[model samples]
Target: MSKPALAVLLTRHPRKPPNILQTLLEVQASLGFVPADALPEIARSLDVTEADVAGVLSYYPDLRTARTGRHLIRVCLGESCMANHGAKVLDRLRAHLKIEVGETTRDGRVTLERTYCVGTCPVGPSLVVDGDVIGRVRPDQIPALLEEYQ
Candidate 1:
């Protein structure tokens, strides 16, 4: 995150009570990923150790330390989706992207991730590309769907 942005986020919550989690979330929302440079500042503001800040970040899966790709592809692994061959879809995506779950492609075009559910069980085999939820996804559809993002 840029210094100005970080400053704005910090000043936005100048309350007497400290809310480290909210501050961290604000930073995450502003910057797609939490910049390492902001940790010491956050720790100082919250009157805690840098390690404490890091521990909180590590506890939340939504918080990211590194930059993400242009597009995020999350495959749903819920029971219904899994039974509907979501695993096959994930496998095909990994093969096509040449990257495994929780990894981004070399070009930084896309990041593949796994989620428990997307609430599209009726359709099942769902995948979310960017922010669009795609249901009833198939292994064969991976290439064409990926093309849209690239």
Candidate 2:
């Protein structure tokens, strides 16, 4: 099935103009992260200045301005996970995928990200693939886990 058009699903007009940050947040939540071109679209739709839209988007660390992959792979970098070799896990994945932590593959298969916490402390060195949590990740196991999706 085709995924829902993120922009239309996210925007909720409350009979008043959406605040600068609110509009962007809605877009981010639905679209995964805001695209660079989305700033102009948001400004035109909300009747807000382009600068205002850009400012709000830049201020939020959770928002990304780049194109992303189909599946978002978020690895916890929390203290527990970090101590358990989370960095090595991320590095191995990056090498196997041939992409940086924040980048997607050429075919747009996956995007790698380092998140602070996924609230799975007991499962340290955890990895979340498209919102499905897998705990106790070992560096060597990343390739086999990713092979399933291929």
**Candidate 1 lDDT by residue in tens digits, 65-103:** 888899999999999998898999999998998999999
lDDT of candidate 1 at residue 144, scale 0 to 100 = 89
The lDDT, on a scale of 0 to 1, for candidate 2 is 0.80
How much is the lDDT of residue 15 in candidate 1? 64
Measured on C-alpha atoms, candidate 1 has an lDDT of: 0.87
Pairing residues by index, what is the TM-score of model 1?
0.92
Q: Write the per-residue lDDT of candidate 2 for residues 21-131, one digit (tens) a residue.
A: 777677776666787766676786778788988888889767887657878899899999998889999999889999987788999999888999889988889999988
Residue 4, candidate 1: alpha-carbon lDDT: 73
Residue pairs with backbone overlap in model 2 = none
Find the candidate with the highest TM-score and give its number.
1
Off by over 4 Å in 1: none
Displacement of residue 71 (Cα, Å) in model 2 is 1.6
